[model samples]
Every structure is written in structure tokens, then in C-alpha cells.
Target: MTTQAADAAGSDKLDSGVLKVAGVVVLGAIMSILDITVVSVALPTFQRDFNATYATVAWTMTAYTLALATVIPITGWAADRFGTKRLYLLSLTLFVGGSVLCSVAWDIGPLIVFRALQGLGGGMLMPLGMTIMTRAAGPDRVGRVMAVLGVPMLLGPIGGPILGGWLIEAAGWHWIFLINLPIGVIAFVLSLRILPKDKPQPSESFDFLGMLLLSPGLALFLYGVSSVPGEGTVAAGKVLIPALIGLALLVSFVLHALRKEHALIDLGLFKNRNLTISTTTLSLFTVAFMGAMLLLPSYFLQVRGETTLHAGLLIAPQGLGAMLTMPMAGRLTDRIGPGKLVLPGIVLIALGMSAFTQVTADSSYVLLLGALFVSGLGMGMTMMPIMSAALASLTHQQVARGSTMMNIIQQTAGSIGTAVMSVILTNQVLNSPEATAYSAVTQGQVPASQVAPAVLDQGQSSLADAFGHTYTIAVVLLALCLIPAFFLPRKRIEKAPDATDEALPVAVGMH
Candidate 1:
């Protein structure tokens, strides 16, 4: 909608300007989520194009994700120091530039380097955008604004793989990154026009020491988490050394923050009762969501013996499920409360996962689709309410720190979740590939000479059973997550009767 039309609809509802800003803000979320989702389907192309091992090629995604995670802590200060719009524009420029560089990267080394640059840029987008959009929305209307922004955050991951898979087949893997260029350009331009025109705050320092402590700590942590045992993409230095250094730096930063009169993140926020409990839940919830989401596709392709395209198609339903359900859940969070929405969402996700717990070598396609939809439905409902409740207790000033902290923990939880599940799946599948391999090998009965190199390289299982066992392991992880969902509270937040609805537009992003 045009800015004028948007203003007309909700004069005091939202800044007429924010409808436009929402597009600009959620671009970061879209970019970050899509990077991982879009590329999973293109691993085969990466293998052929860059001549990479399975472990190394996976880093293209892992490196970006870790780099993104590592840099997330810095965004609040970055925005406070640099001015959100300027930094945001710079981030978009970097992401677009990195995408172009990645498209032309001739070697795997260059590609990985280029992807890291992309991650560095992308790592800031979601949190910063969230800080901006959320601050703009203010507490009174956070529910409404989040409901709007949630569209892209939820859809991007669910859709990224499908969009990337289709585009890769139709255009090429290069198009995946290339596609971001137009989106970035539009967002950058709109940000200049629509984002809150705010001044940088006083006494800004770059916090070089904070960077020193945090980045490597996060990178190391991610490296350890991504390492999948025998399938082994674990970086020894990347996983261990940086992790040690990063941890030391982080610890030192905490000490520094404690000693200093002013620090980037006030360690004092942790003292808040509501903030503490809610943040913990956010972290755990993310671990459950991201860990399981990552496994779904691998289960389909590696264990189920489906082609990449078919696997992607089935996975799309999960996204679809999330897309349809989140809006209602967000509203429900406003109406009932976070507890009701979050707990049921978790339960539904667990139930959907439970459905998969029954998945076997002979499970029907119908059963798989139904379970994915249910799982997606559960997750869709969960994300917004949990986020809303976590931030709800914090004032606007507290939110800037609290939100970033929440993002850090939630993002970290996902990484850890995936790591935990991968360890389990990899070990179990590697050990049990025999039966599944036997079935596919006997059936394809294709001679080695006839099999494609890519097909042959996957190993052991005659493809079919390998995939079946993979799904089996994923279901186990799903079951592990179910244990936690059972304990979440059932209270829902109803809209406060005394809360004023007819005020001037809630001042979002000003915080």
C-alpha cells in the first residue's frame, strides 16, 4: 500500500510510515533465514561447482550462520553508535556485495570467505531490524507490529528452501544469492525514506574489546555445534581454540561490564525476574525449533530416498503450516497471554513430531505430510507469543538490551539444538545404515558403473534405507524436544481491558 493509504487506515494505529518500514525491517530477517534454507538444496551443485567435500560445502552455510550468530551481540551498540538507518544501509550494501562476490567465487575457499562476509552483514539484520521496528511500535502496540513483521520472519525460512530449490533448478545456484540484490536495493532505498530519522546517541565507543571477546567465542561455539562426529565437518581450531578464546573474551567482557560505569550490555538486566525466565524459555524454544527444522529436509533426502526436488516439495508444507498459523497465535497471545499460545504451540509441535515418531521404513507419504503440517502448525503458534512474553516485561530501554540478549540466546539455542540432534542422527545412522543400505542396493541393483557419482558418493544404504534411517533419527530428536514442551505453562494473555486503544500512534523504534 502507498504511504498515504497506509496512514489513512490507521492514523493513530501505526505511523503511516511504518507499513513501509516493516518491509525494510523484515528484509534482514528474510535475508538471514533464506541464506541457510535456500542453499541446502544446492549442496549438490556446490559439490560439482566447487569440488568440495560434503563437510566443507556444509561450511558455506555453517560459517555464515556462526558468523551471523557471533556478530549479533554487537548490533545494539552498532546501531546506538552508528545510527540505525546508516548502519542498516551499510549492512544491505555488504550483503548485496557479498552475494555478488559469492556468485562469481571460483574456488571453495573464496566462496567460504565470501559467505562469511555475507554472514557478517546478515548477522546484524534480524536483530537490528527487530530493535528498530519493535522500538518504533512501542510496548502498547508491540503485539500489532510483531504480528506484521512476523510474516517475513516465519515465511522466509519456510519458503527459502523452496524458492532456492526452484530457482537453482530453473536458473542456477548463483541465482540464489543473486536474487537478494534487487530485494536489498529496494530495501536500502526504502530504509532511507521510511526508517525513523534518528540521531546517533552520545558518547559512542566501538567496544573493540567487546568484539574481541564475543566474536570468536560465538564462532568457536558454533564450530563445535556444527561438527557432526563421523560425518565430521568439525573444525578443530574453529571449534576448540576460538571457542576457548571467545569464552575468555566473553568472560572478560562481563567482568569489564561489571567494573565499568557504562557498558554495552548492562549485566544488570539478568537480575530482572520476568526477563530471566522468559529469556530462558526463548533460548530453549529456539533450540527445539531450529534443531528439528534443520533435520526435516536431511531426513527426507538422505534417509527417505527422495530426490532433492521432491524432498523440498514435502518440506514446503511445513512452512505453509507455519505461515497460516502464526498470525492467529500472535493475536491469541494478545488476547489470552503468552503461556496459552506458547504451551499449546509447543504441544502441537510435539504432537506433530510424535506423529513422526511412528514413521518407519514403510510409512505412507500421506502420514509424512500430515505430520509435517502439524509440526509446522505447532511451531507457527509458538514463535511470536514466546518472543512477545519475553520482551513484554522489559521497558523500552530494557528491551533494546533484553531483545538482543533474547535473540542471542534463541539463535544460540537453535545452533546447539542442531548440533545435539546432528550428533545423535549421525552416530545412529552411521551405525545402522546396513539394513537400509541393503534394501536400496538390492533394489536399484544398478551396477557401480551405472550409478551417478553423486549417488554413489552418498554411501552405504542403497539410498532408500539410508534415508529411512535418517528420518528415524530425526523423529528421535523430535521426541527429545517433546519432553520440555510438556512442562510449559498454559496461561494465555488476554488484552487488558484498561489498556488504551485510541492513543496517538504507538511510538515504535524510538526506544
Candidate 2:
């Protein structure tokens, strides 16, 4: 082929058609991700309405997450058996229907049940969305298309609280869920109108044993991790017993998966060097990044004395920084590769996080916000580009399986990261005399004005130090991300034309 023809063939844009499919996927993902955070603001309301303790109402979030872990393992298999379009529409129906039920729930018990139902539907949406987008974009355009799909994933944490608080104050708590009605309707309509018909491959039999082992194992492990924040230690029986049992089961499943060819999740995909390296990079990055992302809002609320709404609003800069860079990162990843972008992204994140390592009681908002924006820029460049690298070289046949595995890793790693960070911060605050005193003031056990000015100042400073210590750990973890990122593809890799995916060659140089 001539030079011009080669260039023409290589340039793959996310045209109008691909954008439409992406729109549908994003809508579904927003509903799923936003629901998790939006409901977080309503926990207090549930306590008053149902006359239940915080522990009882806490199940509202736990149930949804556990349900998510359980169903995610099966999505790749279901997508293959039922077809992507059909499975996607079904997930939407289940999520929307679950939302309607949650809105009308008479008590917390019913609400928790409804949320689990919602999670079962929500869990499948993400991996399935990835499968659909990847197939639609083809291997060459995966980077740019994934960047479009990433908008909601990055913004949902910031936007959810703001949206939830406004809706609850304006229209009461029920609207938190009822709000999904309109968005779901639009997404469902768009899916029907825009998505192409499904072509399912039903020949592969289901791995029933893998399901029994892995799903329960994931749910139990996550349950224990999620409980650590409430229980305040991993040693609590409620945390340890189930977590140990879950770990054992997971080990068993790994052994089983290696022996079984069509495992519930294909462990064999790890053989792809790009996928393996990207998965490691993703695990480390998500753990550090997501753990710290939640803490930024807490710093605003706890140390700076901001309201929940203001805390969320304060975190918006990070999202804005991400938006500015994500599109450019996506296009570049397609042309160059993820490695070049991801290392710089990790360095930027660590740089931004370093600002938090020295946080004070009265750290300048401008400085902190600027730090957040820089970290956001790093995030935009990092996340989807890593995802793009993982799936970009996957064979058409392996796309669904690869997407499933990555989603599970992201979810599990995020849970572990959040739990670890929370535990460290909680311990740090307990150890700090001033921070403990500040907690009393915030909780109304001690009046702020009655406390001496020196005590108040010392307390706030101590609390900020606790946050700083916690963030120091995050920065260290972000630095660790670079080790794996260095192994990711540094230049465009040409996929081998062979149909067989077993033992794909590791391409390591510029094309």
C-alpha cells in the first residue's frame, strides 16, 4: 500500500455512529454509578424515616455492592449467550424497575432489598457497555471511544452528592431514585433506536462450578472490606470470619479456573502481556486514586468545616481537570500508546498528592484546589488510557472476557483501597488528641466557641495532620503504579493477524 493509504487506514475517528452507541452506554453507566453516590447522601434521611440505627440503614449501600460483585462474574458469559444488545437492554430494564421499587419502599428493609435488585442490574451494565463500545469502535479506535465512555465514570463521584442533595432538599428523598425514571427512559429509547442487533454465540456451556465459587467469594470478601469502616478494624469477627472464608474460596476458584478451559472468568487472558501489565497498573492506580478521591471531600468537610454540598462542589475542580485532558489523552493513546501518557499521569498524581501530605488546618483553598486540578489532569490521562491499552490489542473473540476481568479488578481494588485508607485515617484521628477533640466539637459533644482558641486551632491542625498522614500513604501507592506502568506498551503495537489468541507475542517497540 502507498504511504497515503497506510495513513488513511490507520486514522480511526470516533464518528457519529460510534458516538451514538457511546451515548447509550454512558447513560446506563451514569445511572449505575450515580445511584451509588447519590444514595450515600440519603443515609441520614433513611435513619429518620425508618427509625433505624445507622448500622441498619448502612445495608442500603452494602446490599447494592454485594449484589454487584455477585452478578459481574457472569456478565461476560451472559453477553455471549444472550447477545450484547439484548443483555444490555435487560440490565437497563432491571435497573429502572429496581429504582421504581426503591422509590416506593415502605421501610429500610424493603429499600435495601430493592437496592440489591438494582445492583444486580447495575453490575452488568459497565462490562457490557465496554464490550459494546469496544466492538463498535474496533481495535484501532478503542482509545478515543473509551475516553467518551469515561466521562460519567470520572464525574459521578463529584456530581452524585450535589445532585442528590439538591433533589432531596427540593423534592424530598424519594426523588433521589425517581430522578432515574427520566434518564432511564431516554437511555432505553436510545438503546433500542441506536444500538445494532445482537449476534450471540451460545455454543459454550456455562461454568456452573466457577459461579458457585467465585461469586460468593467476591461478595464475602467485599462485604468484609466494606465493613471495616464501620467496625473500625479488620479483626472484628464480622469482618474477619467472612473475609477469611471468602479468601479461601477465591483461592480455590483460582485453582479451578486454571484447570477449566471456559472458566466463569477467563484467567488465561492474563497471558496477554499488555493486558497483564495494564491490569496491574489499573489495580495499583485505582486503589490509590479512588481512596484519595473520597478523602479530598472529607478534608473539606472535616477540616475546613464545609457542608456536604460544598464539599462535593469543592471537589469539582478535579473532575474539570480530568475532562480537559481525557479526550486528548484518548486520541494520543490510539496513535502512540498508553505507556507514554500513564507514567506522566502517575507522576502528576503523585505531585498533586504531595500537596496533601503536608496539609494544615488552614491550608490555602487556592493551593489545595490547584493541586486537585493537577491530579485530575493526571487521572484523565491515566484511567481510560490504561483501559484502552488493555482492550485495544484483544482479539474480537476475547473482548468480552477481557472487559469482564478488568471491571472485576477495578471494583475489587477500589473497595480495598477505600477500606485501607479509611482504616488508616480513623486510626490516625484516634491517636491525635487535638483531632479527637475536634471530632467532639463537630459532633456537638463540645461547643466550638466554648473551647479555647488555642485548643480549637490545635484541634483543627491535628485533624488536618491526620488527613495528611493518610494522604501520604496514597502518594506512596501512586508512585508504586509507575513500576507496572513502565511495563505497558510505550509505542503503537501491531496486532498479529493470527486468529488464535493463545500465547500472543509481546510487541515492545515503535511501529
lDDT of each: 0.67, 0.87
- In candidate 2, which residue pairs clash? none
* lDDT for each residue of candidate 1 in 116-175, tens digit (9 for 90 to 100): 899888877777776676666545455556767677766666677678778988998899
Residue 208 lDDT, candidate 2, scale 0-100: 94
Write down the lDDT that model 1 would get: 0.67
Instruction: Find the 10 residues in a row with the least total lDDT in model 1.
Output: 495-504
The lDDT, on a scale of 0 to 1, for candidate 2 is: 0.87
Tell how far residue 121 is off in model 1, in angstroms: 1.1
Task: Output the lDDT of residue 230, model 2.
Answer: 88
Query: Which regions in candidate 1 have their CA more than 4 angstroms from the true location?
Result: 1-15, 203-206, 229-242, 433-511
Distance from true location, Cα of 81 in model 2, Å:
0.3
